[model samples]
Target: MGRKLLSLLLFASLATATPAAAAPTAAPQPPTELVTGLSLPWATSFLPDGQSALMTERNSFRVSRVTLDGTRTTVGTVPNSVTTNGEGGLMGIAVSPTWNGTSDQAVYLFHTSTDGGQTQNRVVRMDFDGTTLSNRTVIVSGIRSNTFHNGGQLKFGPDGFLYAGTGDAQDTSTSQNDSSLNGKILRFTTSGQPAPGNPFGTLVYSKGHRNPQGLAWDSAGRMWSAELGDTQFDELNLIVSGHNYGWPICQGSCSTPGMDNPKRTWTTAEASPSSLAIVDDTAYVAALRGQRLWRVELNGENAGATQAYFTNTFGRLRSIVQVPGASAIWISTSNTNGDKLLRSVIQ
Candidate 1:
């Protein structure tokens, strides 16, 4: 689609967007470990219940159920997931909030598969019967992939649409090219088609993303994403359908006419953020290279004061999940032998 067409689509979509988020009322809490000793876990998704969560391992291709007591049960592995040869493999997992152990058991996974010399990433759906993941169903496919910038973030939006965050796959042109699926946040139904009422009449929900790895929705149902930049700035963006984020042409604070400014941005060294979770009202971003968790206070869709926690204490935090019904969250470490899970305990 042309730039003007996209802008018009976005304007139409924005006409229905709820007013900016209400004044957030979240207080920061410290995090603690709940489990330890796992291989390259990529993401953690909480079950509808408060305790157990489905956790995905990158190279292992395994999904395990972990509880507050640190006990874990093997859910299953995605058979065709490529090993993490160059940051590509079984990456993100999203469990449906409505999944019942009986008939509706559904879990979605994003993995990279070998496509000759190049790699292709896809999101597949599997049935989780509280024990094993069966009935593999490939939902979305043919997303071109490279070694780096394979954005693998997935979350179910409040409107019950499955949202997948994709990278530009190291090709900057695709970010601005609406025809390409790379560097975009896509919305689809559980059946894997474009969600009804999506802007641009396609799966592409928002475009012009560089390497978006984290996605979460706030209480007001507004979507937010954490994206990595080339060299200068990393962004925390409030995602709006059909809006342009200005990846290659404009990094941070670009005065480009139609490009959207991020709610917040940090230097690359401080926030190679991956996987975000909203707790209370704050958006907690797990910083991979920064080795910390960032707390961004939200006020009407914009960010206020920010804080960093667990700096360098846990090597390369990968995913953070808000403990359901609690003010604390679960933090996972990406350190080689040091990789472990921690939970917060009020002091």
Candidate 2:
């Protein structure tokens, strides 16, 4: 990598006025490993104080705590979770925006569970007492699940509502069905009811997702999602209420009526995106199969040219969370023996 910066200009349309220009920022420092020996850690939710973080491990159902100095401990476990090989078990986790570790100390989780022995994915909330978990509550249930395509990504949007991305349980038809909870982004109140002002009067916020895994709201409050396509193109979509994302009908972009196109896309081999984090107006996506981190600069809702780092240096990047109060991000790798937590500086 060169230290010299190159100026890049982008325009939305040919008829647009003088284009806005963005110069290449300085290359970031190589990531520093924070912890090791994690078993398929899926998502990372940082504590507001920034000294520690929570990590969820798939197939293990254990929530581990990672401190700034690389200490690790099993803080809690999601009970009744059913493990799956390809894509199941405990998945996304989030810290409640209002949690203060005292009166409202709560953490949220998304996992595949067989509470009824019928097999399904569900969302639950657990009380985090800063060292261990207690007081489990099933907030949402009955979302479809399968060995694959069980999209599990959770985050609280700027509106303070919990938003989750769910898969169609390998049933492509469900992506287009409004009545189905699968293949949709769901919005709910803090207690897990359908949020007010929902476009469909239900939990479904948007539809037509083929294993969408990543969600982040930009600085302007616009929501964005990173979607997985079947053996073709993966997409970064601008999510809006009640919009259809064209899953089975269209892979990338299409002119089909009543279907929305992606703002950007990448080949499946290059970017099987899993989790997204935004910092300094740039969206950083963690890729599982692609084994890299992708940075896409955001100009309002539009995405600029894409850049990738640590292409094969790290094996199967899974989750990334921006460290609060700093220009650094905590990252997790997916390789079995090689799984480790890393901190990469943002530049």
Candidate 3:
């Protein structure tokens, strides 16, 4: 069977027992803009104080800390090692999870740079001295790189290890190669060693992804990933340990043997998911080409209801980060083509 037909059949089998319900629609509420005038913001992470956030701009290789009062300051440059091309550059940033009551902690970054023959992806750590970055070190490197499909998103999982989302670098076969780090979610120690008790007992936690830009865990510690599809079928998946997500072989919902299926899939026109944040049972996905935010309700392992918000008000929503203890969310604008950073207060 064709890929799409097989996917539909699999989804039908999964949801066959339940009656079809109407797709959830977001309640109409005006979005209050918190800040503006940012250039191609890629990611956002809250400072330990909870009132400020650090954001990364893709093309500029600049990182800035913005306060709730609307002030912005440059934390530091991400080093001139990055080569800014189509979809590659300074992409993901995360503050050290051990940043409580200490000045020695740092923020981590994932970016693409040129080696000798081809571009490469590397992860670097930078010390934050309350005002600027101090010592910087490249902790991980040698991942596949290209002008496009350079998946660059990083997060610290509850397991106290750093998790990084990597793209296929436009090479489809790389997704299934165990030796290649491209097109996979890599789990490693804070010092960049492969984390203990990994599925492969190595850095690779899961494989067979196209371009996974979203990585977030629920309150139950279940890891979830949002992937950008090639031509159709953007997906939200419950990331299983050591399972293949079937990128080239299967796109969205999978019926093929030995492959995990997505919990939910949407037409690429409706959802070009980039970044995701989970609060309680709701998974908020940031859409880029779709130009909206998808709020998907999850009950255990099943998708419950889905809704879309901010339909063209903010242009391309590149990334969303929920405030640790607040009701507000920080959304980065993909003005890489033309947008701005926006802070959304859920009303």
Candidate 4:
């Protein structure tokens, strides 16, 4: 063969042998408004049916059922709930995975309440008969509450147990205290007992969290959390049973002997990440102060580069949940002035 022909053939062979770099994940399409005029909405939990979701309004203490078709109905108001006027009030809600609206109609809520003139955070269970909420039962209590750092996001893990993310309640000491429920991610059974094989013998699943607000499980069942740092950085942590995520010790990444560093970190100004949802291989985080939706590509246990969407467009994004049985996500705005719940198509 001629020299030019041989060189061209060698170049083509090398190109075919090299694997192509993966294409970057596309940003979510512009969101469509699903429900409007919400008041500081916080968390969203889709019912088993996937037709609607239960949402909480922070200051209103009202629980509402929001359908995908833009209809909103007040299911019931959580009695005895109080807001700290900052981050407290009716915060997180999770529907029982086994809920049938008949035999097992259990819905869980986390809220701040006043007890004997002291404010505290607690998780309660109620019966939802598909119309109204009733039978309020306090499952877990005595979590410290403050005006600022009251972490309240509840989710059912892939293991069928409930998990709670709590803040340090403005007291940094609680983050390292295993006996304290504040500043920790808690795992428990439906009936309010510590889950089997919990890292500690108590409800504490992991310790040393400053203000963890978001929890999600990747396709491999590994848990991930989004946390608000004090001033320097925000964190996306790979949560492990009993691992201490450096909090007062380290805000984002650290070299402490026994502490776990975050998989990714963003400046506090870039991400006050609240709720997290994993769709396919991407982890979507809703930012409160950042006023955007962050798409973090997940590569196994590690998080890749991030992309922000809807910055300053929808105001402060708070709650985000992957639409059940669909390739979409429902994210809510937290701006107190006529907030809205939006649905965005995940590419």
How do all models score by TM-score? 0.89, 0.92, 0.89, 0.94
- In lDDT terms, how accurate is model 1? 0.85
lDDT of 2 by residue, 3-38 (tens): 332222222343254354455584445899898878
Model 3: what TM-score?
0.89
> lDDT by residue for model 4 over 1-347, one digit each (tens)?
99999999999988886766555556799999999888989998989989988999999999999887869999998887999978999999999998889999899999999756777999999999999999889899999999989999999999999999999999999999999999999999998899999988999999999999999999899999999999999999999999999889998898999999999998999889999999986899999999999999999988997888999998889999999989999999988969999999987
Clash totals, every prediction: 7, 0, 2, 0
Instruction: Candidate 1: list runs displaced more than 4 Å.
Output: 1-30, 114-118, 345-347
lDDT of 1 by residue, 280-304 (tens): 5578898988988888988878998
Candidate 3 Cα misplacement greater than 4 A, ranges = 1-29, 100-103, 115-118
Clashing pairs in 1: 32-342, 32-343, 33-342, 33-343, 34-341, 34-342, 167-183
- All-Cα superposition RMSD per candidate: 12.3, 6.9, 10.7, 3.3
Decoy 4 TM-score against native: 0.94
Consecutive 10-residue window with the lowest summed lDDT within model 1: 20-29
What's the CA error at residue 227 for candidate 3, in Å? Answer: 0.4
| lDDT of each residue in 1-347, candidate 3, tens digit only | 99999999999887974556645443324555566777788888787778788888888888888888658899888874576468889889888876752554679889886545456898888888778876778788888888788899999898888999999999999999988899999999878899988898778999999999999998889999999999989999999789999988999986899889999998998888999988766788998889888889889988778988888877788988887786667777786554566666654
Weakest 10 consecutive residues, lDDT, candidate 4? Answer: 17-26
Highest lDDT model number: 4
Query: What's model 3's overall lDDT?
Result: 0.84
